[model samples]
Target: MGTINDGNTHPGATLPWGMASALPHTKDFREKANGPAYYNFGDEKIYGFGNVNLSGLGCPVAGAVPLKLSTGKFDWDIENFASTYKDEEAYAGYYKVTLEKHQLVAEMTATTRSTIYNFTPQNDDKQPINLFLDLGANTSHRKGGSLKVVSPQLITGSQLDGAFCGFQKSTNIYFALEINQPNPQVKIYENQKVTDKREVKGDKAGVVWTLDQLDQGKLEVRVGISFVSEKNALDNLRKEQGDLSFEGIHQKAIAEWNKQLQKVDIETSSNDDEQIFYTALYHSLLLPHVISDVNGEYYSREIDKVLVADDYTRYSTYSLWDTYRTLHPLLALLYPKEQRDMVVTMLEMYKEWGWLPKWELFGYDTFVMVGDPAVPVISDTYLKGITDFDTELAIEAMLATAANTKKNPTRPGISQYIEHGYIPIDDRGGDPQKFSWTNGIVWGPVSTTLEYNLADYNIAQLANVLGKNELAKEYYRRSDSYKKLYDPKTTFFRPKLKNGNWMESFNPTDRFFDIRWEGSGGKGFVEGNAWQYNFFVPHAMNDLKSLMGEEVFLSKLNDLFSNGEYDLTNEPDITYPYLFNYVKGHEKKTQQLVREKGDLHFTNTPSGIPGNDDAGTLSAWLVFSQLGFFPDAPGIPTYQLTTPKFEKATIHLDDYVYNGQTIEIIKTGENDRYFNQFTIDGKVREEVYQLSHQELVSTNELVFNTVSERLSEVKE
Candidate 1:
């Protein structure tokens, strides 16, 4: 659990979808192998403040352009530059830290495009105040950067860096920094040595400004960042923060967070539970960031050029492999307008790049994880009634990727899968030995096959809705390819060679990273063992249960947990616990598993999350689980019911989807975790295990009665 509970998340300050995040960085801990913005609760040194970050990614990227303040003689050594800090605090939109060594208190808040820093130096040191612009300290390996002192109070720069997930590419970030007071002297440095130039351009370039006076010992700085250019960065700064006070900007950010957080409110007896729920919600909205500038200008890696948005705000950083499971569905439920715009952004990306994004970061296709995930995301959004995007173009994009055979970068190994029912492990001629490009050769064939089949199922649903009968039939046939790998002898999804025979060697428990993809491997699965991948067929679970037989399926499901085969840390097996809802007389087991796992995995501490939130995928899972139901299938509009964790919970659905309707769920029991039955609008439901999306939103209230034991039947 310790390995999975690393909680590779930063306790930072940022808006709900803000591009800029402010994090407290520890200089000494920088050598450790932590994620992008590492802030452990045990570390004490405050090296500097990071201005940009990407949350939950195992590889280091983003977190570019750090800023540190010092009084007296400037020291470039890492050991001398850090200050021991205490009294650290962080909330949804704000972070505060006290640098005890320097007697300085640093507080930060953020807007969508810019960040505000308020620093107050307590000691009356006669030494001059110096500010260091660390251009080289990016999370990604820095290639080169340039810093130019625009004026006594302003500086502008850009850093070129990349290698996200070890994919060799270049990403650049242009930034503008503004100080409230003017400074007389500014010096430039390259590679840690001071230079006499006003501007420097090269690797590890930085600038330092010596403040004439601290203006009553208070220094305020505002930073704006842009993917396009420095001009846009300054434009964003002026438009968002403008001459506003630090308190004003902080208050506005808080108000925005409150507005979004109020969408779902719960009544709980413990403060820890409330914090865990709201904080999980806060983490869930951090990414799929707002990439477009204030003037609707953005950098498009798909075209390798600059582009402009007409009416919608463009977004980037789609961790689709992890997010398509839970985060996007959660968005469709709570933030329908935003989800529609996100789908529009995906369609536009296809128009610009030739294919949809797999694991995108900073406008580049990272190819980080497996699967054709965008299929389920768009299909789920359309089925949920957020159909404001171009449906025809979206369908074309889905088909283009689905039928691709020439080693397309987006849908790797589609050609092989089309020829044979499953992706053969021996079809590894074009597999990438290095993670440099997105040429789309199948790396993990077994996992890719299962994921593509699931995606095909979702695409078939969309095709059926659009009246494309032949296309729907073809995709529906392809969606059943998962059965080809099923071996009744073992009742598991086994890997096969191209010669229509199972691999000679077999070990369902073996797991490792024999390939570039993360997680266990060796038996043809990606990041999971055969035991976990056995239940990958979420679209046709009933058929799977029939194939495995009800008694065997139930026993295996229970053994998965008791024998420690169930992995809650990863996404592939997160839904395994909920499959019991599909079996009659076993729904109570679903409630028991959901409640037990929720308590064991999530907490209120900094290291609370079970795994890399994976761009809020795990957090969204917790959110949905706590809400008393889960969107068990991505493209389906139904939710599998479970027992609520709270006494009362309310969800304020987006007006665009449900006419601003609010669904309140009330649970009545005395410490009882089993579900007895449920009623909607005073009418009892025949099937208490599931609820359709229409039924959930159209009604006003839902009441769940509980007892010490599970009820055999519903009573009117």
Candidate 2:
């Protein structure tokens, strides 16, 4: 997992929903040895530390503000400042490393928007302790930036970022740094020149502070991060970490992590399985970061102005196309309050940008993926009873995005979709490639049709919740449009032209059968073949069963596993294992497949994750599967049940949004591949395959008596 193209996640020392993630700045600062992610686990030489790098994302954006504590030297080159270190340690909200070259120890901990550093020189020698701030050493390409020396102990600056996958350029980050040393000498470098001015502007500048006197050879520093202005950065630093020592900040960060991690408690005998589960849990909590400061002031790229979040937190960095499937659902379930803010954040974006983000990064919609995913995420969150946002505005935004038939940013080729119920393979109406998302021609029309169906059904659900039955019916019909693409001859969802004719060549297994959208291969399906993407009509699975025949549906579902087409690295077919429950007498297959896939793909190693976690989509799959249920159908408010890995696992529930304080999922007989019976508080359930949202969270005890699949039959 090198932070690009696949499931390589870096170690992030950021709290849940924290903006500043302190990571090791390895020697790869010269290039993207690991994309925009700063840490390279295999690299022995670390230059310093950086903040605001993302973890487990398919594409990288910013790895900004690299700083190091060096002594007896002042060089602008990264090689001069780079040092080989050993005994590296990393955890949630905390990172520690020993620099062998500089003979110093560096430890970092973070608040929501700040980083506190503690540096101790191993050999003082009475030499001046040099603090190096490399404003030009970003892993992403440099644009332009500015820096100002506020005083001997403080400095404020900002750097231009946002080249996410060669698209979008508005993720500029600002920072304010404060050191504990009093009356220190400052040396500024601009384009490799030791400048005499107190201000430096450009991408080729760095600042060095030489201090001969320190409090017992210990250097303490705090950095506040902001996306709006430098004043907000300094204000964030002053209020957030006021009077907190290095040790105090480190302990507070650990305590914050514990508070979030303790929301779920599990009883498992396998330490490896437990470690993997918690690691996944930690990763799941790292995204959709809060970008607003304590004063609620943030820059809105949609409006090109700084606005204050009056009653809620403003968040950015939404990988919606990837996280909409399961991550948003998980957040809605466990973190409803925060999820409500996120929904409001999207709604605010709509009010200003006139469209929901396809893949929003740092307040800008990159249009990185196909379809309107924000519909499912926001609709799903609202449908789950998290109604703290504007309802009328939400409905208006969804209707606008869904009904737009011309030059839509979220949904391209929408007019073709409306006229024919499905987009044609040859329709090239919208921008061929908006921004830098490499969608050739019409941008995966077959897949976009399916994606729009899911999104439309989610909006229909939202509409139904508001007693708008007629409006719900309209979207429901739109949702069933995926049925038009089903090829009876091939028994798969094939690409059809505008005139109701199939494409001349149909190869279901050819990954790159047609054009590509960015790195997501395949023409008809983004990053998937027909065998993987054809089962995407979760909203109309009954219709799919009728169209493909129940036997064909089951056979094709089984073929995914038998032919190795069940890609856990991607999202299209991740829910196929749970789809067995939709068919009769196939519940045991779901149980076995879910457990096997979880154990096989998810482990306690660096490569334990099978693919791009896609902003914790796969990790949320593991968390849900290991805890014994999954939100298989997006925006449906239903969870498909499977075998539980733990004997007893308790999940904290929202008292206001849900009916219970805690819900326990207990597996009684054994941790095995199959289960024989399912009950809620000793009462047998007629429908053992799934549970409604109200029914699942309100229940106190949901038990699954499992057994080994020594018996491999579909039913007992």
Predicted model with the maximum TM-score? 1
Off by over 4 Å in 1: 1-4, 27-34, 431-440, 517-519, 709-716
Per residue, candidate 1 scores C-alpha lDDT tens digits across 1-716 of 11135666777889987888888776432333245545556676877887777677667776667787777777766655578888887877899988887678999999998898988877676567777887766666655688777887898888776877768777789899988775546778887788877788876678877775777568888999899999999999999987788999999998999999899999988999998898888878987999999999999975789999889988888999899999999999988887887888888888988888888888878777788999899999988888888989998888778887775877777778989988988884464565334665566677889999999999989989989999889988998988899898887888889999998677887786456655546468877888888888988889889888988788888888888989887888889878888888888888888988999888776668887788888889989999888888888888999889889999998789679998999998654587767999889899998998878888889888886544533211
Tell me how many clashing residue pairs each candidate has.
Answer: 3, 3
Clashing residue pairs, backbone N/CA/C < 3 A, model 1: 512-520, 512-521, 519-527
Model 1 alpha-carbon miss at residue 710, Å: 8.5
Indicate which candidate wins on lDDT.
Answer: 1
Q: What's the TM for model 1?
A: 0.96
Q: Give the poorly placed runs of model 2, Cα more than 4 Å off.
A: 1-6, 31-34, 125-128, 430-441, 513-519, 708-716
lDDT of 2 by residue, 311-338 (tens): 8899988888789888889888888888
lDDT for model 2 comes to: 0.80
TM-scores of the models, in the given order?
0.96, 0.96
